[model samples]
Target: MLNRFKSVVSNVMGGLPAIPHQTEIPEDPNSLQVKFHYNRPDFLFLTSDEVELTADHISRPILVPRCVNKLPWKAGYAEVINAGKSKSNEDQATAMHFHIMAHMTETLLNKTDNQVEMTDMANTGGEFDNSLEYTYFAIFDGHAGTGAALMASNTLHKHIQERLLEVKDLLLCSNEDKMNDILKKRNMSANVNLPTKRITKDSLVKGALETAFCDMDEQIARERTTFRIKGGCTALVALFFGAKLYVANAGDCRAVIYRGEEIIPMSTDFTPVSERKRIAYLGYLQPELLHNEFTHLEFQKRVHRRDIGKKILCRDALMDGWFYKTVEEQDLKYPLIYGEGKRTRVLATIGVTRGFGDHDLKVHSSDIHIKPFLSPVPEVQVYDMTSCEHTEDDILVMGSDGLWDVMTNQDTGRIVREDLRKFSQNEDSRYTSAAQELVSKARGHLHPKGRGWRMENDRPSSGDDITAFIIPLSQLNSPSCSINTQNGHIPEKLENG
Candidate 1:
């Protein structure tokens, strides 16, 4: 079957060689060392041979965790490699608990000496205060390479932990009367004197998430000087802290809440077309960035050399509607943003406007860097899980663009919900089964005659690497969900799974 699958793909492309992805190893073997080897997320619990099976483009098996205990809430996760798009799956995902150690802040306040240092929880032989725990789920969709995605999947949570720890007091304070007292202690510990500003719990978490993305991106940039971290990737993260669910997005990856039959969008897709105004405005502000090879103006049609000075329908960075503008020599240059819908490209190079680590990506045959135009800051949206009632059927679905490329949010919700109906709510594998069904629908089956992969309806299936997570929101409030941790990265045995 696998051989036949490969033969079909070969014939479909007319025997053309697969194009090299951005994450491919450089021809020069002596470049700086790549920081890490490509691997599936540890939570997946795949054996070495099973990991190898994931890279088989022809088989394109939808990989899922072998054990229900692998994820919190027995969350369902499924991923598949693209059909000969890259040498390996460029997408990466992580599911873990980030513990904001309560002892650090508690020790500082109780100790008489201001110079007293906090000891590590492991060294102290103390248990973690599970109340301050936060659940983190993220998906990184690599474009040029998997390095950025791999790097993010491994360390992005640490950056978030650092930021969250800074405001741990505010996050834990439930009494409104003690809010100012908490702020006073926070100011005293830092040895700083500044007027207090109104701070909300959700805002603190959101700010932490936003800054964490920036820190993660900065780390990738700084480390790349000594390490070979190829390509860039879009990030979509869903963080569950206290009663709130925060979704931070910095690229085309998406997150949605499926409550009952309703599909609530939690993040936006920052594509070139969706972010046209922002991209074009930057081009207008810094024309030098274009290298005179592109223009910020948008035209109804490409302005030809012969049509210079002719009237054309156009719009500028400030206007939304097209106006009649006289074409000029500059207008003949390529538009800063090109194509439409999923085909949109910035400076005719990248499709995404926000992500991490594309520092060296330049325009084809030009010195113009695309990094300046790309942003690592994520737009965070919050959903209060405590505000409403939820059931086992309610879930948070997060996926890379590969899944969304071929499925709508409603379609995804319906597939997951319908598949989940086959099993009892207590059966955690039900979620995994739902995730598998979601991935399978997006991935589809090989087309008849091996021409190409296609869906049941005969539409082309998603050829990009697809990943999905179905997290039951009903388990959010369960006490057994916390990850006992001495340090952030090390996962202790869960009290409950």
Candidate 2:
């Protein structure tokens, strides 16, 4: 399948080629660098400063390092040495957290803008007394600009960590009316009368992830005027604590795990098409937000005033049915959900319906801010990895959409299994190597005999910035395993909506 990043922001932003632009490399490559490729049409990255990486993005892609280089963190990074509530000085688990990137597909932009962070949550001064016990992993895919993605990579986890106590406290407190109101606003089912002791681990984690996204987005918007940061990014993160794994996402990025050969998605992708009703309903409730320029009702193409009063098939915002309605004068307005597929956009100004950044951004020539429609509320998913039976091949793959655009969850699971079968963890080219191979397959190699040639089932590589982490859950099995996630990316350029 052709990997075409939708031009979600192009209606106002201008157009560019869908293919990734590459610069000629000098003979004898100096070094290999893993960079984030924001799937935008514009080369918004201006800085050349090297970012300090916490994951294995800089070092060689070796899954099982043979002491080739000093590991950034101690080996068995995922090993949860602290089994009980008492905080231990030793690092958590031995389950490796390795990040590898291929300089993403974009034109003329040499520097990669994507960022990832994996660390023991203990270091960050979170509100939770047991903060030292959890592990955090996230991938921030930026587009249009790098500032937002960079900021998210550095701060989102901290927000999550800090909110841990707030969420738990809120759930435990007796403030029923306030808690119910908050839960209702988040669209979560509310049961404030339930005793605090009955609160499930899932509820606490969900409240934490949701509240963290809210806090993170608020911070981003506040910092926009101060930091002059433009653009936005999708966040996918995983929080591992005790026996449960919490996965949360705000954009197109994905998290997939294997229950033996069965593929399960830990997070949901928030695209215009998937979020049509919610967006349309928001537009319905607040028509002024449309500025008389867009309609909550969506259509295949633009609706001109000339077509007013014409009968057309339409999707209702409140109902789960498709019916025909006569195009009123209001129906001729620009659609709230514009375009189609990957390119479909919520407001014709941005591609992603949810995520962080774009705070100071306004619709071109108008003071109307699009941030009102965009959100940072992540869909958090919980998995009991601790309860599942383990196999050597059982792995958790978290990747940017670049990997998913070309491969399905099943395809990824199959490839991972095959790679392990061919190259075991005992070999140097283990998980990280398999990740690179998976990236290569999604981002097919260049022309002629490569990705350009397009084989019968051409799955050579991804033209987007490809970053993936292949975690060995089998190794992290120290009586407990937990999880959460981050997601989304803006294209470098967008054609007219």
The candidate that wins on TM-score is: 1
Write the residue-wise lDDT of candidate 2 on 193-238 in tens digits.
5433334546777887899888888887676544544467788887
C-alpha RMSD values across all candidates: 8.0, 13.8
Error of 2 at 452 (Å): 4.6
lDDT (tens digit, per residue) of candidate 1 on 181-290: 77777788998787777667778889999999999999998888777788899999999988789999999999999999788999998988888899899999999998
Residue-pair clash count for candidate 2: 50
Instruction: Assess every candidate by TM-score.
Output: 0.86, 0.67
Model 2 weakest 10-residue run by lDDT = 74-83
Clash numbers, per candidate:
3, 50
Instruction: Give me the runs in candidate 1 sitting further than 4 Å from their true place.
Output: 1-31, 104-131, 180-196, 481-497
lDDT of each: 0.79, 0.55
Instruction: Tell me how far candidate 1 lies from the true structure as C-alpha RMSD in angstroms.
Output: 8.0
